[model samples]
Target: MAGIYIHIPFCKQACLYCNFHFSTNKKLIPQLVNAIAKEAFLRQDYLTETIETIYFGGGTPSILPTSDIVFLIDEIKKIFEVNSNTEITLEANPDDIDEANLVAWKKAGINRFSLGIQSFIDAELQWMNRSHNAKQAKHCIDLIKKYFTNYSIDLIFGSQLLSNEDWLVNIKTALSFNPPHLSCYALTIEEKTVLGNKVSKKVISNIDNEKQAQQFNILMKELAIAGFHHYEISNYAQPNFESKHNSSYWQSKHYLGLGPSAHSFNGSTRSWNIANNALYIQSIENNNLQIETEELTTTQQLNEYIMIALRTSGGINLNIIEERFGVTILLELKNKITAWLQANHIEQKNNFIQLTNLGKLYADGIAADLFF
Candidate 1:
């Protein structure tokens, strides 16, 4: 099964740590939406299998009017074959979620929501420059619980302003809501963002990797004790609540992404649209989408598989690697795994190479070492 991702490249306000492609100018909303719809029709054949998920992700899909959202969904349906049980998720912010908006989104076929709650502390929210306050965050969760059953809450950990006590409170607040899923990410100061600029100018302290590691450990321990599956490195779910769309990506399934800065991937090829919103719209209007495409080399594919699978709970399936790449390559991988196994960084069971709790902290490095 495949998935479709529609990027809505507009937000009401810019967050300090955000480096996503979006414009605060609301005037381009109409043109952007229309261009996205056209893009859907243009790239309809990118996925050969049935579409199992359609994710409305972006700068902030929650800011779109209900009618516009409905129009885009309808347009996608008209052009593509969506599965009956497809999961349609909309990434929403706390401030945009109200009773009326929730009802409207449900009517527009958004069965799932990935709410950006960030933090429950007012000071933390202010520091991040999120548009919603702490009160709005709580209210949005309450409203979502009342209206929807399948939703995920996003939280950020490892900020300099957040103490251990504050981090505990954030987790406790999320647990109080009993959300089906939670995605926690450590704050990374990407270059060109406000937070990055502040750090460069010494106006704000940089993120502490040790503190971040501590918080990550705290998260894994608490969430596991709470009976949530640490399904992926940055994602947690209760039972069968894992995100299908994202899971498809990890499984190397084909997906088509529409809109500015969106990436599309088939098994052998990958492509992405230009990041500039105005340029994207103009190019599409001119009947020429400025996209860059690349065919994946065998080594690139093997490296990608290693990177994504290592971050997952199931780890890397040795048999699949052997089958796809070759037994020689698998043997080479096994030698590397043997070293890690001796170091207590990895465990081999039933031909799968899974990470140990301690090893997870250095997952990226281990994956890179194993890459051919």
Candidate 2:
């Protein structure tokens, strides 16, 4: 099954730690929505499989009008083979989650929501420069619980304002809502963001690695005790409630991504659109393709698979590696992982290499070390 990702590149305000391709300009919403719809029809033949998931991610997709959301979904349905049970997800911020909006989104075919709650502390929300307050966050979740069964909460840990006690409180507060899924991320400072500039100027201290690691361990322990599965490094979900769209991505399923700065991948080639909104709109209007493509070599594909699969609960499949990359390379991988195995980071169970809790913390580093 294939999936579709639509990026809405507008936001109500800028967050300190955000580096995604998004603008705070609301003036271009109508034009950008039309451009996105046009691009969708233009690239209708990009995926060969039936569409099983449609994810609206962004600069906060919930900021769009219900009419815009409906128009795009209708356009997509007319051009593609969408499944009856397709999982349609919209990433929303707490400030945009009023009851009226929730009702409209439901009618427009949004089956799931990924809320950017960030933190439950009022001071933390202010520190992050989020548009919503603590009360609004709780109220929005309450509204969602009444109407939606499959919803996810996003929380950030290791922030300057969040102590270890506050981190525990944040996780427990999220669990209080009994959400089906939770996506907890560490607040990493990117060079291009406001937070990064503060660190670079020495206005604030850099991330304390030990403190961050401790918070992550606390997260793993708390979530495990609460009966949530750590399916991906940054994602946790209850049984049968994992995000189909995001999971499809990790499994390397074919998908079409529409809008500025969005990436698409089939089995062999991957492509992305222009990051500039005006430029992307202009190219679509002129019927000019503004995307760049790359052909993945065998080693590149294997390394990519190794990087992604190791972050997941499924771990790496040695049999599939041998089949796809030949026995020589698979033997090399086996030899490479010996030290990791001895260090009690990763363990092989029935030929599948899964990470221990300790391994999860250094997952990315380990994946890079194991790359071909």
Candidate 3:
């Protein structure tokens, strides 16, 4: 099955650590939405299969008025063949969520939410320059429970300000809310972000890998004990609560992405729209979209497959590799896996190779090592 991703490239404020393509300027919101809808029709045949998921991710989709949100969804439905039981998700910030907005969002056909409740601590919020405070973070969860049952909350761990105690509180607080899904990420300071600048200037310390590893271990142990499935490296969910759209991505399903800075992948090629808002809108206004694409080579595809599959709970399926890429590649992969298995970094059972707790900490390195 296929999926659709609509990028809403507007936010009320910029977070200190965010490097996403978004503008704090709300004046371009209408044009951006219209541009995305137009792009949908332009790329209508990109995915030949029926659409199974529609994800509204962005600077903050919840920042949009209910009418704008509805218009986007309606436009998508008109242009694409969406299944009746399609998973429609919106990414929202805590400050933008309220009873009225939550009710309106639900009514507008959004079945899932990925709330940006980065932390349940006021200090951490301040450090990140988040628009919402701790109280709003907590209150928004309450409102979400009242409106939508299938929701996920995002939490950031391993910030310099977040001690182990604070990290525990953040995890426990999310558990207290009983969200169906949780996506906890270790904070990384990207090169162009404000957090990165601070690190370069020594105003704030860089991320301590050791502390981050500790926090990740805590997440695994606690979430496992709490009955949450560690479905992906950065995601946890209750039974049957896995994110269909994201899972489609990890499984290398085709999807059409509409809007500036959005990426689309068919089985063999990858395309991405331009990142500039005004340029994207202007080009689409002229009935053209500035995009770049690359066709994957056999080796590139195999390496990508190994990287993505290794990060998931299902791990790498050797049989699929043998069938698709041939026995030679499969034998090469098996020989490499032998090293990790001997090091206690990977466990093999039932023809699947999955990361151990120590392996998860070095997932990227291991995936890179296994790359062809």
Candidate 4:
């Protein structure tokens, strides 16, 4: 029903395309881990429901020692009610995956892994400045498969380095490993990232939208042919293998986020920890966790739901909308979606208005059109 997200804000190296809140300072690891555990205990009442998932995300969670990982999980269990079969996931990069670490992680209560194997091509991996090589990427999957059954691979498409043929090779290589789930994201250039800077200075070209769209289509078709469900816009999974933690966000389930730059959501409000690691640790150690909070208006919540629900295969549930926001609002939503329905971008399934495969390409634009 709910989840907990712990942000580990340290990485072995900085990737060229990343703009996330993280540090190359490994010295902060011990302090940050202890601070995160304390933060979890302090915010124990944020989610009232039983915890279905616990996700360790960040710059790279696998950078932690196995003992630290165990201590954190034990700390969380002491303060919260975790599900017996909870999906405790650690986001890892391939370079950090070795037999010893994998064995230790399994014993440390990490039942799932979301591997950051962005590409299986050495050239592309180098282009992204990834810490792992293509060989490590393949080897890690084989290692993880020996331990966890409910694991996911993270892949990136729409890179200028990836041609349609190269994208197919990446997909096929991942599928060959039979990972239960795959999350394929389009490479977005943020102004603060190294790649973004290059583009700003005209040192390199940006991603071509037409090429990106073509690769996405190829991704969908290939995944579907391989019997993976297009459950969310960026996610594909075999049956019953969808990510529980990420799904909770789309379903608007309450969760507690710990550590720097992590965000938490209750039904009506959103709060986020400060992005600066030093400041976050300092504040938490002082027994005052600093975060910016915002209370959502009814219209804001409705629009948020519209945006999230439309991206999902379940689409918008007319019944839930009516129940929560009133019948009048639901009727207006229906009226707003009439054009999309007529254009065959979206279709109705009983009370659900979901995107057609074609509509998935324009998911954001369509969701904006239906916004309150």
Name the best candidate (by lDDT). Answer: 2
> Candidate 2, residue 37: CA error in Å?
0.9
Each candidate's TM vs. the true structure? 0.98, 0.99, 0.99, 0.98
Tens-place lDDT per residue, model 2, 1-372, is 999999999998899999999999888899999999999889987997999999999988999998999999989999999998999999999988888889999999999999999999999999899999999999999999999999999999999889999999999999999999999999999999999999999998999888999999999999999999999999999999999999998999999999999999999999999999999999999999699999999999999999999989999999999999999999999999999999999999987998899998899889988998
Better of 2 and 3 by lDDT: 2
lDDT tens digits, residue span 74-118, model 4: 998989998899999999999899999988999888998999999
Query: Model 2, residue 93: displacement in angstroms?
Result: 0.4
**lDDT of all predictions, in order shown?**
0.93, 0.94, 0.92, 0.93
- Give me the runs in candidate 1 sitting further than 4 Å from their true place: none
Q: In candidate 3, how many Å is residue 322 off?
A: 1.1
Candidate 1 per-residue lDDT, tens place, 1-372, comes to: 899999998898899999898889988899999999999888777777888999999999999999999999999889999888899999999999999999999888999999999999999999899999989999999999998889999999999899888999999999999999999998999989999999999999999989888999999999999999998999999998999999999999999999999999988999999999999999999889899999999999999999999999999999999999999999899888888999998998898899988888889899999988
Instruction: List candidate 2 segments past 4 Å from native.
Output: none
